[model samples]
Structure formats: structure tokens, C-alpha cells
Target: MTTSLGPMAPGDIRTRAQIRQEFGGSPQGGICPSDEKKSVNLYSDPSIGEHVGYYDGWLAEEDELGPVFEYTGAGLTGDQTFDGPFGMGNRSILRHAEQGRKLRVFIRAGTIKGTATATHRYVGTFNLDQRLPYVWRKVRGENGEVRSVIVFRLRPDGAFKSSAADTIPAAKKTTVEFVQFQPITASMLNSGPATQGALSLPSQRQGAKSSARKRTTNASTEGVFVVSEAFNTEMSLRAATAASIAVRREAALTKSYRAHLEAAGHTVGAFQIRVEGLSSTLRTDLYDATSHVLYEAKGSSSREDVRMAIGQLLDYSRYVKTDAHPHEPRQAILLPAAPDPDIRVLLERHQIGLVHQLSDGQFTGPDFTAPS
Candidate 1:
């Protein structure tokens, strides 16, 4: 069977037997660990119909960072653990990420009417989200007892395509707890560092303290300021309905500009601002510490994109703490190309600076060090 199956690509559909023959794992479970290949195959069958307690599918649409597919860990009938003798399925996934094992995923299609075997569509390869690998949520077990489950956040390795039916439904209301997992790095893996600090599961008391500190910090900022890295937006099951191509382009543009700034010996990072009473956070694309400038990047130089950048820069500047810099930081718009003449005039009128990348890849803008 293995000899006849051949190799599987991103969207190939195959039965459990064929997948097992080609890869390695039990024919029955969700997590198939192949020690020989150092890979784990995760099978998600939404047809099981929520008996397992969490939906496993691609986010309805991509988020700011890009498309994310959520997959629940093993042990649906019992409490899921990260490591140890129990929950081998869950542990296999963690080790797959830590040891840099290939993580392949598939979604159940339907059965072949007469036969009992189920077929699955290969989604693509994925990597654990480096920032936050998984979140702990409670779910009802088979016997009606509440049990903890680990929901892993996965990011696609490259282009991924899936049917609309594969979109995850809105998540039910539940208390979600964040667990800190050190991102896997080549240095850490090659050196074989001890696991003590790699995974930190906060104690109940410690969790409470952490929450309290977060609230206090939010209060201190008067509801508007946070270092980008420390801010975690509340989880929303409602996936984006809009196309994500623009968002992806915007992310890429921001990343490239950030690198350009750093290469010129300037310090760069972002800021997360939360308006008072609002559940959402507004994140600035780049903050140049060397020049004390706040920049909002746009993927296109269209009027709409330029307007959005202007508004965002203005709104973000209002809440920046006075002590954050020696003086008030200047505001600017970073665009892929220069805007129209009228748009340039509008920016000048508003005392906003403009920075645009030329075809040759060099950036042109006002001297950031000069007084606004």
C-alpha cells in the first residue's frame, strides 16, 4: 500500500491507511508520531461535530500577522497535558516544534459511501506561533466533566488553500488562559538547553498577580499605551471576512522599512495603543527611537491608504507618554511610493512628514533629526 500511495502534496486527498503507510502513526488517533521521520501528522475531522469541545480549522480569514489555523491538542475525553506519560499525542506536537520536526496537517473530507475508511485533505505544513504557542481552555469531557484542553496556534509555512467548509465557526464563550512558551531557536536546540525555563506554566496565584499587574499598567497609561511585544489582544473567534492580501502586503512593507531603519543604526520597534473603553488595540508599524518619530506604513500610495496612515499616526501620537521621549516625537507616514501632489500638500498642511521608497530601494524623506 505504501509503495503504491506515492508522495502526498499540499492538497492531496488520501485515506488513513495510505497516510499511515507513507508516514507513520496509528490508523485510529488524531496525532500520528513518526519517530523514524521525526514528524507528526495532525488529522482534524470537523465532522466529529464538536463532541471534542473545540473547533479545529483555518481562522475564517487572516489576522494582521497573516492567516492562522487553530488546531486543538489530543485527549478530547480527558484533560490534555503538554508533556509526561499521558497525552503522548500532545507531547509529540510540542516535541515536533522544539526539536524542529516536520508538522503536517490534514482535514477530513467524507467517507467513500460504501467503504468505512475516511479520506482527508492535506492542508499544508505549519509551524507553532513563536509568540504564543497555545492557550488553555476548559471543555466538557465525554462524561460531562469539565477538562482542560490545549489549543495550539499554527501559522502556515507558505501559500495555503482550503475550502470554505474548513473555516472554524465562532468559538463559544470560555475562560482562556495564556501560557508562555519560549520560541524554538536553532541556538537553543543545537545547545540542548535544559527545559526548566523553556516552558513556564504559571501557578494560579502567579496568574492572578500577572493579571493584576496588567490591569495596573493599563490604568497607569490611562488606557492607551503598551509596548507592542507585551500587548495581547483579547481572543476573538470571529474570523476576518475581508481578503488578507492587502494586510499581508502591509506587513511586508512595514518589515522591510523596519530593517532599513535598523541598518542605518537607528533603533526601531512598535507601539500598541488601546483607546479607553475599547476592546481592540491599535498597533503602530514602526517607532524610530533614534529620531523620535512614529511612522504608520501603508502598502500602497493610494489616497485611501495615505489617509488611513495619517489618521493612525495622529491617533497614536495623542496617547504616547510625555516621558517616553526627550520631547514630543514627530509623526510621519511611510508609503511604498510617493503620494499625489495634492496629497503631499495635505500632509505639509497638517505638519506631517512623508517618507517613501524609490524604485532603486533607497528611502526619501525629510531629515527626521530636524525640528518639525
Candidate 2:
């Protein structure tokens, strides 16, 4: 049962005007203050003169997020996807959310009536949906530019009583809640690994577009970042597998490769190292103890999957190395299935090695000659 009042419930809901008249606060935007004289911005920012926040909805004509209301932070000034912890508008909402503050929500009431006064509907008090609060969505900025914005999903406080008519409509199913984002903690922001929560593995912003990766994967909160659908059952069956399964597959592939190398009279080894002044440790998937070859593995062979694998392999090769020199290992991308000839060509163009799964359950690759 919902705590919110129905649309026609009398004295159970207030319009934006009522709150303002009773609270006797300023008419400014963003976080508005009421007669109780409490500060109510998404996040507090003394800098950038951001004492208020702009609430917005990016709903398509037929789209909805159940009874939850989603609001975007200010500052769509550029093409970069907004980061939560660093901005005045974005970071403030995150802070308020972490502190368990309920921000009032309002919608422009005169859209259909064309009223002269800026009237709004006092929807209800909403708290950040702590389960999966934020997402990166495309929005048109104040400058008429399209860019990614951090959208905070707010659910009505169970304690706040409202009439049924006032409640937002529920969606048909939870299947469409595809974009689940992890809130960036102060600790995560201070550290520099670009985490795509349920999507690809954590990476640095060197060779790959992290946002693009996130958009392509549409990962769930369960830690499985995969395509929403596959072209065929076999081709797309792995998409339904858990991300943990992918990790295990990578580990199994590494074990098989090590055994194969050992059988071929090549000594295989793994490497790990800690960098100074960084809290995160770096490790290689596999390194040839004898041949100094470094391998990075992907769970699938799609273009995006292979692309991320390339970036990871390169990043690993750059940091992890043998006693001889840095980046000295023959870099190779390991995959569970063969990619297209074009993908192989892309690898060869970069002078990187490619090893893919053979149909009979054995792996074959490094097709290009590794410099002896």
C-alpha cells in the first residue's frame, strides 16, 4: 500500500503555491526553502553560488519509472557525462541523498493551461531510491545541446501519507529499469579507476570510451553487464550468464593457456605489482614466464567486448612487465570465440596478438608472429 494521498484527496496534498505561501521562502529555483526556514538544495554548495537545484524529468512520452520521480542535476554545459562528486548541482544531490534528506518535488502545472504565473504541483517528499539511485541519460541542456546527465531516481517516502490520485502511475514491469548506477563515494572519486559498475571491468580513461561501454552493456545491479538481447540463442546465450561466470571463464581460459604453454616447452608466469601513492593494485591476467608474453581475456567476442579487451590488454601491458623492461611482453587479446576478420585486422594494425577459442574447446591464436 502506498503512503501517498490520491489525486482528489482533500487536505492531503499541497500545490507548489501552497508550500511557498505557507513557508514564506524565496521563489528561487533548485532547492526551495519553506516557512520552516530550512535549507533544501539537493546538495549544499557555497561555491559556484549554488544554493538551489533545478529538478527535471527526461521521460519519453510513453516512458515511466513506476511511482518514482527522476531528477537531473544542473550543468549540462558540455558533452562529457556529468560526474556526481565534483559538481555543485550533481554532488550536492548525492550528498543530500547520502544524508537521508527528503527533497520536495514539483512539476510545471501550467503546461497545458498556459498560465502566466509559474504554478507547480507539490508532488510529494521523495528520498533517493537507495537500491540503484542514479543513471547516465541523454538530455538537452539549457544551451540546447544534447549530453549525458546524471539522473537521480527518487521514490516517495513510505512515511509520507498521500491520496491515491496524487500518486504517480506505476510501470507495467521492472524489466525496463535497465540503467542502474552506483553512487560514487568520496573514496571512489579520489581513486582513479573508471568503474562501469555492472558493465565492463574497471579501467582507466586511456584508449576506450567508458561511457560508450556502459551504454552498450545495459548491465544490471546483479553484476552482469551484457547485451540486452542476442541475435540467436547460441550467439546470445552467454549474455544471460552472470558476470561472475565471465570472470570464472577468464580464469579457466588462463589455466588452459598456461598448461598449453607449459606443454609446448614455454614457461608461463603471472605478474603483480603495486604502484606508489595509489591504493589500487594492478595485476596481469597471464604472462609468459619464458617468452614474456602478456594476455588479456574477454568473455565474449563482440566488437564492443573485443574493443574493451584491447584497451585492458594494452593498459595491463603498459603497467605489468617482466624483469627485462616495461611493456616488453608480447601483448595479446584472449577471447572465448573468434571475432570477425576485421577485428583481427584491427588487432594486427595495432601490432597486438589475438588468441580466440577454437570450436573444439581448445584455444588458438597469436596467429601473427611474435617478435623473437
Candidate 3:
């Protein structure tokens, strides 16, 4: 007789036995594939001992897009491959997106309130992030040796309820190289071979609009020491998505500050610095022509926000000098409100000024003097 399973919604709790009865899959493994329904169930248990090398949990914080759930592929030691017995779980997840298979996620909760049986909290359906599907990380294996493992990036299809217990503690900051996979189709095979070309650098300054791309040339006949253009590809994508509430607040803060500067009769603009050999470019938030100051704006006054603003101000100061401001522009940070005393001291140590908006809609900061 077919089992009649009630509707399972996001944030609902279900036990392993009930899940197996509703969805036909093994109760042992982390990845359960149901061939009859073409769906996959992903299970993550934080209670599992780390000695077993099971590092599955939600990323510490959400990005501008949304919450990211990281699931480690199956394997105990050595390099994890996608071919043999251990490969079944990893392959099922990797092909889920391309194969149009549905993914239902669950995280292990301690146990039902009054019962000893374990329960899993449903985390809603998710899909592999197209921009970055997976990143390889080195973690200790079951044998006490370090080995590379695949960590898939899964984004929720809709609303996601976050739980502190399911979040992995923030790890030491390390460079993560993301791998992007694109499905090959018949149309792509029939198309001509793709061509590679150098990025064209514009040589003329555009209008005074903040989004306009401009090329700054050295006044000296030094033969164009550096080029500055507007780099907004990533920013444009972020603006289009408008997913993260934090990102929206930051954008609003930036816009308000720009309007304040303009109202005060100050010439303000932004720049994207591009060096000859580098493919990536650095973009500044605001450049004051009247006072010759470079201001990096942040929505919040948190330590992390202040730290990022400090780095951007220092980095952009190097390339912001032009004919109008021959020397490196005085660096400063713009914030919605004053940061902590320690943050103020930190900014002072770096010789960077701080500007914050007051309740009366006025800005207060160090005096900006034209560079001599």
C-alpha cells in the first residue's frame, strides 16, 4: 500500500523514519536519491564528531545574495573523486542542477522535545549557485592527515530560516578559488570557437556623472603612468538583484552622502582604477574635487565595516591623484554614524579622517584641505 505522507513545508520538522517512509531512500547516508521522483535529499548533522571529517554546515553569514549552505562531498581521506563507491553522493548533488532534479535540505536537530528519536529541521529547497558551484578546501581527514574536499555552494530557492546551531563558526580568513561549471549543449558545439581579446581601455574622460568611465592621464610626459575607469560590472549585478537588506541599506547611505556633498557645493565623483597588466580594477566611492579628499562610505559602523573602509581608502588613495590633485588625495571614511572610540583611534593611527552623518542631516569630520 502506498504511504500517504502529509505536505512537508519549509521549516517543518521530520524524523528519519518518517522521511524514509514518505520518501523512499536509505536512512544511513547523507545523500538520499529517489529515482522514482528524481529528487535528492541532503542531510547535515553538526553533532557528528569532527574526527570523522564531516564538515557540513551553513556558512557563517549570508552574502549580498542570500544564505549559503555548504555541504561537503562524501569521502574520508585523500583526494575526493567523483567515480567510485564514495562518489555516488557527490555525483548526485553535482548533477542535480543540470539534470533538473529537486533538492530538499535538512539539518539535524538534537532530538524531539520529549522523545529520544532524532529529528531534522527542513531548510527548504536549494539550487547550486551558478556563479560559484563549489570550492575545494583542505580539512583534516579521518586518518589525521589533511586532504582536499569539495564544498558545494547551495542557495535557497525561496525563504530560508536560519538557526544558530546549524551555522559553522567563522574560520580564519583564507583565499577561496571558486570553480564554475557550465553545461555543454548542441548549440554551443555548433557555434564557432570562442576568441580571446585584450580589454580595451578608454582614453578620454567621460561626463561628470558618477557612473561615467573616465581615463586619467599623468600631467608629466611620463607616457600615461596609470589609467582610471569606472568599474561597475559587479556593482550593477548587485543593484539588479537587490536581495540583501544590508546591501540595500549601504546603497541608500552612499546615495544620501553623495547628495549631501553636492548640496554643499562640492564637486564629487567616483573612479575605477585600472593598471596596465592587471585584469581587475579598484573602484572608489566618492572623490571630492573642491577639497581633494577620497571618502570611502560604509552603511554601518561595525568593526568589520570600518576595517573594510580603511583598506579601500588606502588602496584607492594610491591611484586617485590626477592633474587637479597632483598628490595622493587625503583619505577618509564616510559612515552613517560615528564608529566606536577604538575604531576612531584606528583611523587616526592610519592618518585617515572619519566623516559621519548627524541626526540633523549634517556631516561632521576632519577638515579637508587641498593637497599642496
Q: Where does candidate 2 stray beyond 4 Å?
A: 1-241, 325-327, 367-371
Least accurate stretch of 10 residues (summed lDDT) in model 3?
222-231
lDDT of 3 by residue, 46-140 (tens): 65636755456565444455456778777766766455576677767766644456667888866867888888877767766543455445556
For each candidate in turn, the TM-score is 0.48, 0.35, 0.46
TM-score for candidate 3: 0.46
Task: Put down candidate 1 lDDT per residue, 91-196, tens digits, no spaces.
Answer: 5665564454666888888776799878888777776654345555555654676666667777766534456666655432322122222222323223332111
Q: Write the per-residue lDDT of candidate 2 for residues 250-318, one digit (tens) a residue.
A: 656666666676677765554433233221123456666456677777767789878887787766565
Ten contiguous residues minimizing lDDT sum, candidate 2: 228-237
Tell me the spans in candidate 1 whose CA falls farther than 4 Å from its real position.
1-6, 141-143, 171-372
Worst 10 residues of 1 by lDDT: 206-215
Query: All candidates' lDDT scores?
Result: 0.61, 0.45, 0.59
1 versus 2: better lDDT goes to: 1
